[model samples]
Target: MGKREHCRTSVLFFPTFVNRFGCGKAQCTGVPSFRIGHAGFLDRLVWPDLNRRLSVAKETIVNRSNRAGQIAELRKVVMWLYDKGRYHDALPGAVQLVDWSRDSHGSSYPELADSINILAMTYHALGQYDAAEPLHVEALELRRRCNGERSCAVAMSMNNLAALHFDCGKFGKSEELYLRSLEIDRNAQTLHNLGVLYHAMGRFAEAKPLFHEALEIRHEAPGENSSSFALTLNCLAALYFRMSDYAQAESLWRRALKIRGRVSGRRHPDYARTLNNLGAVYYILGELARAERFFMRALRIRRQVFGDIHGECAQTLDNLGSVSRAKGRFKKAL
Candidate 1:
């Protein structure tokens, strides 16, 4: 008889026959019969058949567990590299994470989206917008798929894409995405970004309220001394400087500088930015010596953080040259 027929016959008649004959170690011709409805019967009849299936299930569980641990470790390393500004070093790991998440089940869509977003952000930091844009688009679509259209995740993706477009000088597209993100979620970062976009467009009146709103939200959530709050303070100060409100600009810049100093110290790039902005304010106020000092400090910090060839260092050099010329030292300016 065929194997299928033999298996079907055994299943259909074995239990009744064993029970009726009370076959507990009973000998039937040359074969030992198994007792029905007992552990012995299951072990005797099914162990060989089920052992291979059980082993496969066990191996699958172990592999999944190992993959999950690997993903967790990758996330930690990727985030650490990003925080340290090691974008190039982080890129391979971020790409690996994306590939792994994509190969995972549909339940891992959120992980896939996160990996895509991080990879896009790393590309953006490297100024490779061509590579970054499609990744951001894919991340947004994945987030929308995993977490509905109006979710905070979707809103964050929208905000990131908007920032990318803004950097690319696609103002209209950026503004549209920013507005859509704000409509979905009243996030402090989104508010600040939209305000910055408005400020860039010279819409001072529109930008002011948004900046204030963002500041208030950040202050309430992360508190006034938070880096995010200091960032908004610096942005608003920049707007004030552009508007020629020197005193107000000086005050805000000073506060931001103090906060940054307390949080990140003098060697930080953020502290250098505040120093540069403060120097600009002093330059406008005609305090040439004070302006020169701030500019020098900013230049020193920028050189330390980004070396000599950075745009920030060049800008600080120009500011110093302006200070020298303003003090009637034309030779020094040159």
Candidate 2:
């Protein structure tokens, strides 16, 4: 097998080990699994630390124009920083690039508009909705001017704008934008985002197909470990669990758990989500012993990663209570 294929094969078995040992007790923190000796998104990508790359990308943006090559390279660098979880640090560089790309007097105005759209995304991640909204609007205008409403570029801007709307609880606006984006690409990410939006709105029936579609796409994609794919898997698993599809749910959650082990490592707070999902599946499967074990492990991880009182910890604690009750440990359940 090729190097990438080999990695994927290993990823496939990673969760089985996690199910056996339970994510290492010491591994839980906000840090991703890849950073903890497991190769993850950051390691898979070429970019270095967020702060360092931000500086370099900013400098490159200043010296370069809106030329296709420069713009593409700038995007690559900026995206890499975002994927590394350096949302805040990416902002300054992204803003500078947006400024250059948006200057109507320059030949690069279209590029600036595109850059602004990208900036909108980074801002959305950092919870700077006010900052992101205007950029999305500006990008929409530019895209319309350059590519018309039906073009793929317009669709891209719409999707980002929709995400912003979703973040702000504007489900209608977000839905409209996602539908528009879907018309253009019908891509996995757009579908996944749509699934999340639907889930948030309590529309599970509408959400499941999108999650399933994204999972299939990820399964076929190049990487063995991806946060997006793992997330989608978790979503599907949770959905199945909610519907009492215990067998399917357990299978999916177990798969997702392994990916989290390999991609996010055993200790990240996100891993707790996988653990909780898996624990719930075990609970439903009437494996109280296994359920209690997973819940306690998740609880410890959450406490270490998020400290006491975080919502996730509370949920983990509750799961522990449930498992205890199921085992007839009344005092512990209490």
Candidate 3:
């Protein structure tokens, strides 16, 4: 077999092994039955320990008689892993989901579209944007085919594609999609995403009202203390900080931080993000000591969640270094 075909075969059979062996804790103890000719491909494509466990236990999950139930359980596991930030581990399962859906019903099936969406999301999370965009495009087309042009499903797909474009720095395309999505449904998430895009483009005046509208929608729908509401508040705080309104920014950030803390705890990435932003505000205000404390706390939490070399951890390090320099601790800053 060609390299691509061999790799595909490996992924396909790995799940069969899992299904037959059972996925429970005790069921994963045996040796994996399937083997890939290109070991490097497996190493590069899958998380080692997770792939082994899944390969052993995926088969015993449900009988061959209950295909739908098996797919549902697999989807749940894939989403759970994705939620836990195990993006690499989630990718294989997402691929299996798409394959199963397509094989059972056709490429144009609704379940195929859903699986494609999950696979795209997993790729996006893993920073494989090139791989993600085409899948997202396919998913959008499938959703439109199945649900009509102006349906909520189509609008959601637009928003997701917009997010991908925004992340890729295609601001024009992102804005166009966001506008289209807004026309279909006045959703809070779409509004907040547009606000974020505007903020990134330095269009603070245009961003502020969008953020406000999003916050209002969230407050009305899910209440003020919801994580989504806190996210909008954080975005507004960032805009205020950019405008040099330090006092206003600090107040907004603190409120958002409190809400995030209550909802997701201080260890959550959102809470750490707020802490970092608050530290920057304090640093700008010449409260070096207080800024250092916040930066340190943010660094600790980011290290716990994302480890030492991630963007967030690096940003906190930069801020801490600046504070040290301001305090005349040249050696420490270095």
Candidate 4:
């Protein structure tokens, strides 16, 4: 539902991610006492052992010693990748989960529906909206069948479909479904998404309170320092940015940057959004050097996730071009 993302690097180069346990001689922007630089976040810490984790899960599935528990372990592995912004890596496991669930359970089983949502959301994260939509529709139907139309599961299904519509610029459809979901359940996610839709529609005055209320709800449930809270903060910051309240926007986005980094990490699209937003703020303040650094970091992350021509990368490139123009670097601007 969000372009969720990582790192602090100087303007001239990419950030060096070292071991979190690197020698405490040098300090950089990092998590607590562990500096962010060369933190080996994914390579040494997360990804290095990922194959082993996947292999163990696969072996358990093959052995079928405890089929339900084995599949749950596989789901956890796949979700771990998905949650960490490793959508490309998670695709195979997600597909396998759906396939196995359908074959072993049934077409109408709740497990299959849940697997489909995971796969669909992963596709959504990758900007494969078309691939995600039908799966969302199928999952919604399955949810209605399995848990009844008015159940929380169906509401979640509606919210997922709504977010996809919102991403696709189907504001009216998105609003309809979001409102429907809200009627069924007033969860923080649906409320935040609705606020985002209103923000996009230029109904800033209407959007403001929804964000605030959602933030309050999230504060109560997930507490103040969760990814859900960060998302709401990011959108609220974006709203302030649109309203030309630069200081407030920057302040709010700064909070989101720290929170997302701590919870979601830097290898995510959402983190890139925060970076790009901060860069825009700096650009507006005529801080070209600062703006360039943030833009370059965001651009690199977007390229890694979506490649060069994708909309997110293109947006960052355009921002960089504008920064060059502002600095009278006409060749770079062109």
Candidate 5:
């Protein structure tokens, strides 16, 4: 219905033995990306942290010849930052996009709803649930009002809001919105997120099929990116890990790790996530040395990229502590 991007950064990474991926179009592009952007969008994809992507976005803005073009470029920048897990940087751009959309198209415009959805998800990614919820609610209401309840736009909004609810531990609300979304479209993002919710709630039996369904949809998607496919693998591995099926979890995580390493690289948070997950699995299997090695690697990456103030940091630290405790390194654990 509109040309808004689908910033898939709303996928809450599970604070468990695994990570989760995103929902919606390939991110702010109106295609289901599940938190992936065009990984090859830039030349050779240089990165310590996708610096090349940022540089190109800046260069593109300089080249755009009109207000519309600039706005379009800015939206891409916001979505890229969000997809790459750069929420702190994405926030200002997301807010600016919302304001620009509203100024150009008014409060009730479909474009504005999309911008609002992106901003709400920025907050969602930051773990600012209180700030995120109302914006998510507003986006859903605006989209439903502007486009009605049965469209893809509405379904996308439902997925966004449901993800927020999942993070907030509002299982009933999350499930309600996800089911409503699936009723409109059995898209990959919603299926993956709904499955994640079921996994978090300990409904392993229900979550498994949904994860499989989501994976199949992703497999069938044309030109599917490794990030999304890896995430589905990651979260499904998480489910198996929760079920004490370490062998299954390890196999899935290994697949995800390979894909993420190839696409997102070792320094990327997605790669760090699989490292942390593997650590947890090894810990459970009494491979203390292996668990400690993986935990250390993941912790280093999180600390370098996200600093000390994010859930990624917290989760990795907790894992490290467990490793130290297991190894009788009490001071290190502390």
Candidate 6:
């Protein structure tokens, strides 16, 4: 019953939100135009009115589509606000939709399930683990009742709940749930997550085969440069590094870095982690020059992305300092 803490910064910028006018200006301009910002003015006037209408619609609405549309629009707005790091503003609207979906249409089980999932995720994001847990449990129960436990939808619910367990440090419970979910994935991504769980638990022997299996599946079913694939490669690289297989580790780290860069930008934390891992491989290989370069690059990127006091940046700095000291650059190390 643990909710994920809401520490994630908003991925969306309020200034870049697309207006209802459907101009798609945000997508086209790469920056929101004045017209989009002006739309906030409309919210001031319409939001109160919409809330009144939405409340009435939920109770006595004869029109299904209109009620659905109103709730959907509110959900979208809540999601947008959440993405913008405006959790306080987003929560009430999200809760409103949860109530609406639960009560408005008696036959809309699927919609209700989806809304519950969203509510659960939102609560998780806010660190309300106690609140999030029951919501996820409810959704899982509904999915299982509607579509057998082996169904992909149920697998997703189990995986999500397992992740929540992992985040909450319930490793034994997480392992049990993950194993159940793994039986249902029949796909590389799920296996990859299982591999990561194994790696986290220091079960390198178990993790390695799973990573290789995921890689093979991805090789056969290639498409977009998926973060999941990159993560699999990175986990394998880390496991290899732990085993002192520097050559294989370095190769996988570079490949993971390339995929992460292509998909999530070079400045992303995933790339920083890859860079750090690659540097560790070089450090062990006694290739001090290459190690220093990668470590420094990683340090800089982590600092820029997460700031100097962040744990990731601190780790990178410590690594760079250790490497410098080993190379007899004591002054530089300091």
Judging by TM-score against the true structure, name the best candidate.
Answer: 5
Clashing pairs in 2: 15-258, 27-267, 28-267, 29-267, 32-264, 33-264, 33-265, 101-112, 102-112
Highest-lDDT candidate: 5
Candidate scoring better on lDDT of 1 and 5: 5
Candidate 3 positional error at 186, Å? 1.6
- Candidate 3, pairs of clashing residues: 18-57, 18-58, 18-59, 19-58, 19-59, 19-60, 20-59, 20-60, 22-57
Write model 3 residue lDDT over 110-161, tens digit each, in one string. Answer: 6777778778777765557799899889988998898789866676668768
Each candidate's number of clashing pairs is: 0, 9, 9, 18, 13, 7
Give model 2's TM-score versus the native structure: 0.63
**Residue pairs with backbone overlap in model 1:** none
lDDT agreement with native, every candidate: 0.62, 0.59, 0.64, 0.67, 0.69, 0.57
For candidate 5, lDDT tens digit of each residue in 1-334? Answer: 1212232323446463533321111111122323344221221223375565566556643464565555666777777666666667888878877776776778777777777877877777677879878987888798888888887777877877777777766889989988987787776677778788877777778889988876776675522355667878888888878888899989999998898787777887778878888888998899989988998898888777677887778877877787788889999899
Off by over 4 Å in 2: 1-43, 48-77, 103-108, 264-334
Cα shift from native, residue 306, model 5 (Å): 2.4
- Residues 1-334 of candidate 1: C-alpha lDDT, one tens digit per residue: 1111000000000000101110001000000121211101111122234344434433533476667656655655555444433456667877876776776645346777777877887676556779989988988898788889987678777877887787676879989998997787775666777777787777889889987987777666556765556777877887777787779988997998898786556776667777877777778787878988988898887777556875557667877888888888999899
**What is the alpha-carbon lDDT of model 6 when measured against the actual structure?**
0.57
Give me the runs in candidate 3 sitting further than 4 Å from their true place: 1-57, 60-63, 84-89
| Better lDDT candidate (4, 5) | 5
Return the lDDT, model 4, position 266. Answer: 91
Estimate candidate 2's RMSD in Å. 9.2
Q: Whole-model lDDT for model 4 versus the true structure?
A: 0.67
Candidate 6 residues 137-255, lDDT tens each? 88778778766778665765676576567556587887787688667655554455566567667787887887787677655444326544566667677677667677887788788
RMSD of each: 26.0, 9.2, 14.1, 10.2, 5.1, 12.7
Score every model by TM-score: 0.72, 0.63, 0.76, 0.83, 0.84, 0.61
lDDT, candidate 4, 165-231, per-residue tens: 8777688998999899778777666676678778777888888998898778767755677666677
Give one digit per residue, the lDDT tens place, for model 2 in 1-334.
1111111100101111122211111100011112211211234565446466545555664566544555455555655555444455556767765655554335334566656765776665545679878978887788688767776566656766776787676889889888876776665556767776776666789889887776676667644476556766766666665566779878987887788777666875456667776777787778888887888788787666546855557667777777777788989888
